[model samples]
Target: MDPAVLREDMVDGLESDAKGVLHDETVAVAMRDVPRHEFLEDDRTAYADRELEVLGTRVLAPSTVARLLQPLDLEDGHDVLLVGAGVGYTAAVVAEIVGETNVHAVDISRPLVIEARQNLARAGYGGVLVDCRDGANGFPEYAPFDRILLEAAAVDPPRALLEQLTDSGRIVFPCGTQRQRLEAVSADSEREAFAAVSFDPLLVEGEQSGAVERNRMTREDREHATRRAESRRGWEQEWIEWEESVGPQ
Candidate 1:
């Protein structure tokens, strides 16, 4: 039960014809190198192809992670941004492929961000950047990432994330709300769907864990009302009396 042997078996299973979730040699090697146990509390199940919940966020299973990353076509020295850095496992795997300094991750939950940072550092990827920011907003401070991977599901790729992609950059995300598909989109707006996937919806600022407002729709409604109030016109603000206007004139 050596961790290295476990890692090797994990990648091998993913590459096997029955699963075929992992085919890219680069990604396969990276998965083998990154110690998944460093990111999980139970070392016994570290290499298992199953999801686990960490800090109220669901950590993607190994096969799911492979499916998510295989579409990115990651390259050495590529600047990558990972949205929804749950347990930092995916970020660590990516760092192994693209160097530690090139990986940047953002999460809406502050506690998860802190945990991911600590886990990543312990995993020897201390150079990777883990920040607490709403995944939809993305990490704009480091704009123009060469590759962006959104671990959560959204009906459409967030506008901010798309705007932050380099001209040749590609973003891989689970696209949709009710039903999801693993898809990749280029900065030029071309898209390609890979497979059906189920993922938690992307969290907004007020919907994240430990936020005062846990209801995303309610916050959205409040913001919509604010926009409506700001856009109120002459007649839209209050009811106008046609009779009073004529009489006054």
Candidate 2:
């Protein structure tokens, strides 16, 4: 019952003809090398091809990880950004493929971000940077990433994330609401849709888990929205007179 052997069997299951979720041997090898147990609370179930909940976030199933990563077609030394770091398992797997120093991750939940950072460090991917930020804004400091992976679902790719990609960079995420499909888009706006999948919607500052309140009418939420609105231009801006609309109502 060695963890390494469990990893091998996990990869084998993913690669089997019946599943065929994984095709890239490079990615497969990386999955084998990453110790998934370090990121989850239950070490016994870490290698299982099932999702586990941690810190109110569902750690993506192994097949889902493979499905998301295979389309990225990652390369070593590539600068990669993961929008929803979750428990940091996906980021660790990505660090394995693209080199630890080249990986960056962001999450809206501060608790999740703290947990992810600790998990990554424990897994020996201490070089991967995990920060607390709204996934919609992305990690702008590390702009022009070679690839971006969004673990949350959105009606469309976040404009900020798309803008942060390198000229040839590609982003993969689940697109839609009630129904969703895994899709990837390149810098040029060309898109490809893959399997149907469900993911939690991307969250903003006030909507994150353990926030003071879910209502966006709070002072903090309004101020955050106002700041974001002020920075937006043209059709991108939602026509809301913040003070008049949400104040004392």
By TM-score, who's the top model here?
Answer: 1
The lowest-lDDT stretch of 10 consecutive residues in candidate 1 is 240-249
Model 1, residue 6: distance off in Å is: 0.9
lDDT of each: 0.90, 0.90
lDDT of 2: 0.90
Off by over 4 Å in 2: 215-249
Q: After best superposition, candidate 1 residue 144: deviation in angstroms?
A: 1.0
Question: Could you give candidate 2's per-residue lDDT for residues 1-249 as a string of tens digits?
Answer: 888888889999999998989998988999999999998867669999998888888888999999999889999999999998889999999999889999999988899999999999999999999988788898889888999999888988989999999999999999999899999999999999998899988777778878887735565767998899778975575675666756795
Candidate 1 overall lDDT versus native: 0.90
RMSD of each: 2.8, 7.4
Please give the distance, in angstroms, between residue 195's alpha carbon in candidate 1 and its true position after superposition. 1.3
Give a tens-digit lDDT track for model 1, residues 103-155. 99998889999999999999999999999877888888998899999988888
Per-model TM against the reference = 0.91, 0.86
